[model samples]
Target: METVAQRQIHSLLAKYGESHLNHTNELIHFICIPAIVFSFLGMIWALHPLAAIAVTVVSLLYYFRLSVPFALGMLLMSGAMLWMLSVLSQDQVLKVSLAVFVVAWIGQFIGHKIEGKKPSFFDDLRFLLIGPLFVLSFLYRRFHIAY
Candidate 1:
């Protein structure tokens, strides 16, 4: 029998896949999504340490509700990003994060343009959260792990 996570993952991936059918777009997403995640985390970290912690906690909780393995992976990834942010000088954190955020978004738009479809996030804001999981699903497939 399929788990709740499996069913949800399938639904989310189907929605996410609609706009990501182009090979070029997929390649672009492979590069940009992680950058966007890290940059967003960095920007939150720059606001205040507590803000960053709050974001991480809320994000992990959401992922946990969807799937344990995905949540665990995100926790590890988020922890590492936060650690890297912690090491940066206060001023550099905001600046570097801003730069990456802008570039990554540009890449996202370019991918969408190539795909000839608007981003799924525009239809439902939750796609913002779905994006990372969509990317992770590919890795899960590669590793032969059921998401």
Candidate 2:
């Protein structure tokens, strides 16, 4: 039987998958979404390292409830992104992250234009969080890991 969390994850992924039907759009997301996540982490890290750490902890807990393998993968990726963020000077983190965030969003809009669909987040904010998981689901599939 599917656990409640697994069922929820699958449902959310299916909803998220709808607007990402175009191959070019999916390809853009495969690159831009991670960049957006990294930049968001960096921006949070700039405010306070603790704030960034807190987000990571909460996010991992949420992911853990949904899928253990995905949570682990996200944990590793989060660690690396945090490490990269930590190395930048405080001012540099803000500037660099802002630049990346803007560029990544531009890429997202372009992809959506090609897809001819409004972003899922416009209809529901939680899709913002679901986007990264959508990308990770692809990785999980390639590895034959049940998520």
Candidate 3:
């Protein structure tokens, strides 16, 4: 059975159409997402585990409460990037990843244009974080996680 949290995320993804993201946008998102995560993790990892955990909790609270769409976008990008990184050389991959990040963000701007509405993240920052969890939840649903 899906947790209430998972169900809420799924409801949003269903409305938004996960596969609807542009192909190029998807590629760009993947390349940049993980880089950001690791970089942040690296910064916090040196601290005691409890302090790191605190930072994570605070960060997540910011994410879910603030910019959810951007967050979801990051999640999808992170998953795709993980797969790409496993195959590519480090230097070349970083360069490619940077390029993709720029392009994908541009694509997001374009999407908002088409929608005739500002990005949801602009309204509620949680949407940015929610975006990533949204993507992750898809995998759970696909594998038939009891949810």
For each candidate, the alpha-carbon lDDT, in order, equals 0.90, 0.93, 0.50
lDDT of 1 by residue, 7-126 (tens): 887898898899999999998998899899999998988889789989999999999988888898888888988889999999899999999999999999999999999999999898
State the lDDT of candidate 2 residue by residue for 10-49, as single tens digits: 9999999999999999999999999999999998998999
Model 2 alpha-carbon drift over 4 Å, by segment:
none
Candidate 3's error at 5, in angstroms? 2.8
lDDT per residue as tens, model 3, 1-147: 655665665666554444335554444334433444543333343333344446556655554543454354444554454444545554454465455556656666665555455655565665555555544555556677533
Using lDDT as the measure, what is the rank order of every candidate, best first?
A: 2, 1, 3
Off by over 4 Å in 1: none
Higher lDDT: candidate 2 or 3? 2
| Each model's backbone clash number | 0, 0, 25
- Of candidate 3, the 10-residue stretch with the lowest lDDT total is 39-48
Candidate 2 lDDT score at position 18: 97
Model 2 clashing residue pairs (backbone): none
